[model samples]
Target chain A: MNPASPAIDTESVTALLERGRTLATPVLRAAVDRLAPPMDTVAAYHFGWIDAEGNPSSGDSGKAVRPALALLSAEAAGAAPEVGIPGAVAVELVHNFSLLHDDLMDGDEQRRHRDTVWKVHGPAQAILVGDALFALANEILLELGTVDAGRATRRLTLATRKLIDGQAQDISYEHRERVTVEECLEMEGNKTGALLACAVSIGAVLGGADDRTADTLEKYGYHLGLAFQAVDDVLGIWGDPDATGKRPWSDLRQRKKSLPVVAALAAGGPASERLAQILAADAQKSETEIADFTEEEFASRAALIEEAGGREWTSQEARRQHATAIAALDEIEMPEKVRAQLVALADFVVVRER
Target chain B: MNPASPAIDTESVTALLERGRTLATPVLRAAVDRLAPPMDTVAAYHFGWIDAEGNPSSGDSGKAVRPALALLSAEAAGAAPEVGIPGAVAVELVHNFSLLHDDLMDGDEQRRHRDTVWKVHGPAQAILVGDALFALANEILLELGTVDAGRATRRLTLATRKLIDGQAQDISYEHRERVTVEECLEMEGNKTGALLACAVSIGAVLGGADDRTADTLEKYGYHLGLAFQAVDDVLGIWGDPDATGKRPWSDLRQRKKSLPVVAALAAGGPASERLAQILAADAQKSETEIADFTEEEFASRAALIEEAGGREWTSQEARRQHATAIAALDEIEMPEKVRAQLVALADFVVVRER
Candidate 1:
């Protein structure tokens, strides 16, 4: 590979994501506008479209990665990117819907450098607004009155059920004393991979692509989601505080049994033993003790995980998943530009800093 | 109507409801069975098909009113009852979904003579299982692979959104000092009427009924819902505790701004003024004060509302809505037996004991 490819891919992916967001934003806004006052207002605040006082704000709304993949998937099926707007809008809505509920369930107060919906509007509003967005996603898709619209809606609903299953598993796992690596992967596959797989394939489904092409696209997306999550897990422990908008060792502070930690626990080493002891203490500590823990304590736990080869194992798994995601693209022929953009997005996901 | 009609209608409606439950139960169970463990178990418990220990128990599931409406609607549209199974399952799922969430949001511990979902499982499980049931409702509708399936899905989604809006409004109203009569009715229309409206019409939609027929049937269900809610409000204040399984003046105990209370507040007179003062005192009291208040105190408030004509007005309104609901059937052609069953169900709703 050429040495300059990283710079070129970064620029290309940024343009692609921006273009996808540009196309999908109006459509998303239109559907959200269909909601009544308080729900619409809360949704607007959650989406970074407004402040707590209902004034317009320019806050960040994430990377638009899922939307970009949706648009490109439509293009991959030899349709205009416009064909994927419903897919884009549906996914973004579902993504934010999950974020809203998960935040409340996780007891999080801040997100995107602002107070969360529950913190600002209250938990009831958060639940209702999240439900409203989910209903809107289906309303938008089924209104198309086409066979493809029906199929796409079905796919999205199944993915959403799987997503809920993943959350249930995640919550249950947190309370248990031990979680296997296989169990963790199964949960993440359902939680993260299912929705992304639907996002990428739903566009092709809407574009009237055959089952084989949609299936291949889903493979690409499923692997991409795993890779993205692996990177997120690594960042959760060691990412720069400024870039991530989180405290140092945020995941450890929350007692998250993320992929890296699960893998380290499975490795069976001296460092793994030490890490388990710290985690056992974490599990037994009261709320006050957990809150009183210092960064150095978390850092030492992070260091133990690294010594156990967890960081390396997780990084290699991300690269492996990334390679598999790119390989799925080779199974089907598509426009060269679309292929390039998909590849660029995959690279960006695997290597993103935050 | 003939002198013998009430007895015959009561027996016939009982037979019809039993039939609808028998038909829809397997389909509902199958859809719920598709959910993963814990969620599936929680849903089963919510349906009264199982006990808290996961053992099968004959707990009371509501009367399955929505399912009966869907089946009758399909018969009204000249289709076999089997064609409406999807509609029956979807509405039942959605109804229970709302119940699960509402129980949590309302902070009620008891429902249908047993512990609520949140009381049985934690709040997080309540939230997740409720979410899963909602998703399952859509999945059941869209899997039928027909044009009517698409239309029915669209209708159900809109109704779900309205139901959520009603829940949001209900929560907000609980904190406010006063709620207008019209506001209370509007909220009930969305919360209770919208889903019932969809339940009655969705089956006909699945059977390819015309828009006029669907709309008229919706009118029937909407009015029936109001009648049902009015009866409910009346029972909340004055029903027999042994039959209703609730204390006398239960609505007042919870500070509910139900239809009777709102109407009583709106009527201007000495009794109305006294009722308002009592309500004002009730709202300002602490939890301990509320719990310590004697039954006679609540009984006095009830007496004031009755003297202000709130009880009589609500009963008259129930009759009016019941008449309106039965009248809607005249606008469309249907079998005589189907129409009779529909009328019977409407009568049952307005006069149910619990």
Candidate 2:
């Protein structure tokens, strides 16, 4: 399961995630059965291996990207990969907790080609599922054995706080008419970066790396998250639907205060004005209209993004962040090959089309 | 602040609730500032001394029942009241977390005579506020000091799981058209009773009580919760609005599947059929013509309850639980008078009105 080769590719990441699932399955499955039968249905559905009737099925449940990040970071930090799986489980649970709630908040009825957790289970049970996951995450962390309990608790608790903080900012931005690029970055940093940072930080802690090494890996993970989000924002507007499987300019339609939009908005010209007009249009505009903005409109918005330095700026920022990540890994005095894997993973994040 | 006081003696309980607020304010206020500014706004509104705009005011926020239960149980357990105040705060936070999410799921737009947190801040922020409260509860429990940290964490974590389990059952019953009175009792026992039990358990833990004493106090809290909820059901069906501040039989109109309704449904007679008819009309009905049934209807339900021996059943159950609790305390070899005061408080739970 080499992270670099396609032979060691998404399937390898899936294998790592599956390893975590196996480790966590017994405790989590039993707890869900005892405490939340309905939510167990919702969670199983969310995992994409179950139908609406709560019966098992076969489907893809994404790459388990975040969990892989956690496990690899731990291994990169010199922790035993097998022992790192529990922390990966905790991170994955937190990720899913946010996703369940986020779907409800965003009014997203569908996810991964199936009805979202809330759309099927309703908001009440969805909320409970999120809560159950949160508790289970901590419960898993507590099983780290007392020797590592305090350190694991500290890292994971702080990560949980950051994830919550990120979500708060994300919701707040929806109502705001304006936002600075800096503010948008801060929001993205907390929302997406914190968890990724924690994935790596947990690795450092479990790998029994020094505090300095742990901190370095944390910075790397954080920057990687920010860069990943920036690229995602770019793809959200213009990526091929065949590849990304998202409606074109869906971010624009929702008036989402994304990074590229923030940059274009700050540029303040005809392009910005047009962008504002499109955003100000009732959000329920038809899909045809959303994807069919005039060529002039598209060109203006593109110019605005370029003029605001969105493309050049975010690209450089991504590279710089990646560099910082790599430098941090070097400072930790890790095995060069392991550090290379982390660095390669960081690059892969920004390079993804979807 | 005396738990032994009669229910009408709101003055003491109110004062105790205020004291719990006072003790919690410094720590919670600081944490809110640091971790979750957006959620803090909603939390302030939820606390009921604030307008939607987050302006402070003098509003009767809530009865603070859970915190009072925690503080009083701690006092009865022979701990210095001040020392256990943090435990009281943790329990109160858990209560509020549940309430914030509850209002959203129930579509309860108003609470404490003001717009609910979700109504004022929207569901997203409200959800985050609940999450923040959960995180803060864990952080506050850690303040019980390093020596006590392990016990505190375990107790709080278990308590949290039980809280979610209770909520899970509640949501499940809502969708499942038919549920027995026994099942309803079990649901409330988990959702509401678990917290009450934890309130006392946490108090005992913080109070440095022996395991036997803590276990006894926990049982006392559990029965007290059942008694409290049962009395509340009585008030919901037959009590005056002027006395209870809510319309009589509101639970019936809402198709609450409360203990009485479950009993009547199990009885399966004309009364049960009529009750079913009313519930079938609308699960959220609340008009007097619909909500409050005739004396015959009330009598029928009461007879069913009596026939099923619910009142006597629960009464004897409560007493048995309390006696077990008292025996556990006796094993601790505490002073007889202190034990008497706690026993009286447990009795008051069954008899309280308004």
Candidate 3:
């Protein structure tokens, strides 16, 4: 490696993330604990802090990527990370709330290598706990008592609305035979991009950044979110199950209208045609028929997707988004250290294996 | 019946309620319409503005009671009703969100003489649309762009949390063998009173009422909410199905631990013991056994509750709460005409047949 390549300081970024998570997790847990019990219990279980029986459990809480972004963005906007703590907590709460409900809606049985909230506690409890967490996010923000509390709330609310709309669109796409790549991208933007953008912009607003700087930071986060999701889509299909914590080819097996699948369908090559035939056959099968489908059949379909250039296109899209995100960061005139950290975060988001 | 007595002007109160509902329904519908389809379709159906197939319908939208309370509180706090429009819309949206989720949770098939959103649209859609409406409520409140928006959002968030807690407790009670009247009332306060109190207090806050007046008005709504729930419990068991639009003896059939039933169990008469035996027998029975339990059996249990003085106790409690509600209003020092209308609204709440 060159002595000075301008690459992200991976060690420093990791330390910053760890520090932010350590500070934010307890505040997030405390907010969840404030909920009325049974709900508190369900929320704790969802956050991997407790078992379903309300006993303590050493379980995995997903890497606090959103909270880290919020804290980092605050520092980039010229304030201490502490000034962004409330924003960090709010983003984490909203993220978990979406996960809890999304798991129930999608009938996902496992997440983060454990039984999901709905699988362990039932759908009603999951729904209620999700609601409690969403309300808790707003409550924590209002308790900030800062001048930007209202603006922060408005931002979160709008993002939440878009998030719901995006999920709704994703669900609707499942019933359609064809979905455009543009429509798929719009859905991804709403489902993932809105919240990430809100997280960074909220931190900037809380840290007293001017409107232009905050807006630029939001653009950076938005493109980063898109790049992050594109990479996630890649990992969803081809990444090792042990690393991704998902079933191998789960999106393909579920016939989800993910980015690669949509792009493959749009590619219209011979391989794309064969891939469409396989998916349609899978869709028409009964439960027993689907159960009888061999892993070899799944492998061939994945091969067809790659041969059709879907995987290549998705990787290229991720890199394109990553480049755009970095360009947006150039519009904001922050300190050199902060700019490097931001660029490193963007790079990590697009390039991570899982 | 005395002409000289200062009885409530029910006619004027009804006119005020109709006016409030008329003004607020469009805003509420517009908000629901803003949701993406089929969520928009599901929301419209839930609002009783259309059929499941998207055709227009003349269905009941409940009494619009909460919105009326908001607008009236604004007027009583020395502002025009239009000043409370946002508050009214927020309360109504929250109320509908709860209804949507509660119907799904409770597995109720019918509401307001029509099928529920969950029954027609499925639970996932119902849950999503309910979530959308909830987010929309916060969005509308924040859109007010007033100095009081943050405070209003806080009040609504707290009330919504309590409301969810109360519902969680209500579901938990269904699994328990016995519940105390005090516990039941506390649950009722959280479930019903919190939102009502929020409605009145929010209207006062928006109308620029001073703290003492707003506090007093909240107290008034809180007591009124208790009275309203007590009355609803009575009607749940004894009101005409044609009038109430619920199954005959619905609460008794479901073995709900409503206020009257709890009070009767606490009363500890032979009738109470007999009623407990019947419910226990029903609970222990198989599905087929319960199905064979006849309508005559349900009526006999209702008779047993009356013979135990439960119905009489509930009615007396309703009157007691009604008096306390009126007394709270007396401390507010509002105009004579407005106070009369407030009292009338309280009277209508406690004395309504449906």
Candidate 4:
């Protein structure tokens, strides 16, 4: 709550995101359709546009946040949002591709209130479909036939490499008894920030923004991604299951080494010591023995995480990142309305209940 | 096998391939090392440079056939082989990426006489490393900083899509009672032909070849790929295990509906009927029952496949396609020495024992 900060109108940002999703859906669909049959069918299911049986579905794809950022960045860079449709489609495809692969790697059976692609189709198909979507993203970028294609492709490719690196680190962390907060943050930056930065900067590049402005927008996105992940960490323990479409205390149940958990463990308080003991004991248990945690046990673990100041530290960090993102926007000389939209989006990212 | 065709020089072509492998090895190793550790280790092991425990070991990495084709195509198109290093690197990376994923999907435990990546490093790391290599391929192409970056990326992306499509079809065919010979051929074209075509044409494009010449080179590659796959099918059935690094009748034991099997099924003879009966009987067996197939049964099955003229049809087709590949090269007006090299390479592809 800084008094000097600009007011964020969440309603307008929501509407803008809706518009971006509508604008990008057909383009994304066409790009996906270019894949071979079963893979295309599998991708369609992953996108929430169809059921596993090939029937139409009314399932929800998430907020289309990355594509919205791309279109909005294009607008902020002095071009019509239509000019950014290709960028928007590419980002959305990449996002879905990551989701498909991550679900398989993490052994997640469900996503967005539905069975995951791997669970429905199989791991082999999921991997292939993820790969196909990634290739389609590149295909869409090249087919855009713009002068910025090379720049856009290079940026996206680098981001993808970093994203894979982040996933690898995340998997490796699961095997360790402890992970430092700094390492966790670095992983989050690569896992989440790299793609979001690409999403924002790619639009600017395509919209003909100068180098300085593009870099500034990329910074804004990077910080925004950090803020988003921080809030997500808090929600993983405390958010309503109905809101998140996840089991209660999902991350805690899985002993995920997310930011808040790492922070709590590093705090060196009585609560932190108890939390570490609980985690170590759980780790030592066989898979059959570890499955018997009661609701009360989960609730107490969440309370301990908060008692260790993990919640406070994470909340403060999220606010800091949000503020930093908005400050970066101030460095970019864009139209006032577009700047307002960007600020609102940043605010929505950190402040959303879900 | 045609007497009127150019004489094949196997020794020189073998030496040229070895030279290409030496040049591309360091670059491929460096690019793969750029992946996150453990993933890098997995990739290195997959490339046969190290053992599973990360110790250096001598392991064969196939023929580096695709990279050699890329370099030779560059030479044929009037550029130094060095000019096509990036293209060679990219093709080789894509090839290895496919191998990694394919090993996982096919449940193949062994490759190049060693444990497959998924078997040694786990499926998650194998998938991630495969993705990293694919991203690296795109990175190398863009880093080429050539005017052909977009074209090269597009060609590679399209080839990747077809490769996935072909694999999807291959998997789906396993569930079907019969697959047409033409359908089998088309799948082979997509699975194997597309990447080989990309390997040849990307080199020509990078070498500043005219569009017509590039198209001709692509055609040569396409036919060469079909011939190569046909020969591979033959080897899968009857090639010596000591030379092929696989069990004799490996494809038959797995009941793989490879081109020869499909052609035999379509031929509708007594041996074909008997082969079909054995396959159906095998399909009906439980896992434990299936595992009881004796070496004598495998031998009998291979004998039956030959009796159906499957082996003969596939061999004749391979030679015909090899001839077609040489004919396509005749349409390109390259220097005599380069033409001879290419013809030699194509002949060697069909004639290799392993």
For candidate 4, lDDT tens digit of each residue in A115-200? 99989999989999998888888889887655577678778888899899999999999999999999999999999998998888
Count of backbone collisions in candidate 3 = 0
The per-model lDDT (C-alpha) reads 0.87, 0.68, 0.84, 0.85
For residue B235, give model 4's deviation from the true position in Å. Answer: 0.4
Residue A300 lDDT in model 4? Answer: 90
Per-residue CA lDDT of candidate 4, range B212-327, in tens? 88889889889899989999999999888888887667787667899788888778889999998988888887756655788888888888888898998998888888888888
DockQ of all models, two decimals each: 0.78, 0.49, 0.73, 0.72
C-alpha lDDT (0 to 100) for residue B216 of candidate 2: 68
Candidate 2 chain B lowest-lDDT run of ten: B1-10
For this target, which candidate reaches the highest lDDT against the unseen true structure? 1
Residue pairs in candidate 3 whose N, alpha carbon or C atoms collide under 3 angstroms: none
lDDT of candidate 2 over A208-252, digit per residue (tens): 766677777788888888877887788777666566656655565
Question: How many clashes (backbone N, Cα, C below 3 Å) per candidate?
Answer: 0, 2, 0, 0
Which stretches of candidate 1 lie above 4 Å from their native place?
Answer: A1-8, B2-8
lDDT of 3 by residue, B287-338 (tens): 5575466899878988888888889898887888878888898787777877
Ranking by lDDT: 1, 4, 3, 2
What TM-score number comes out for model 1? Answer: 0.97
Q: After superposition, how far is residue B211 of candidate 1 from its true place, in Å?
A: 2.4
Candidate 4 clashes between residue pairs 3 or more apart in a chain or in different chains: none
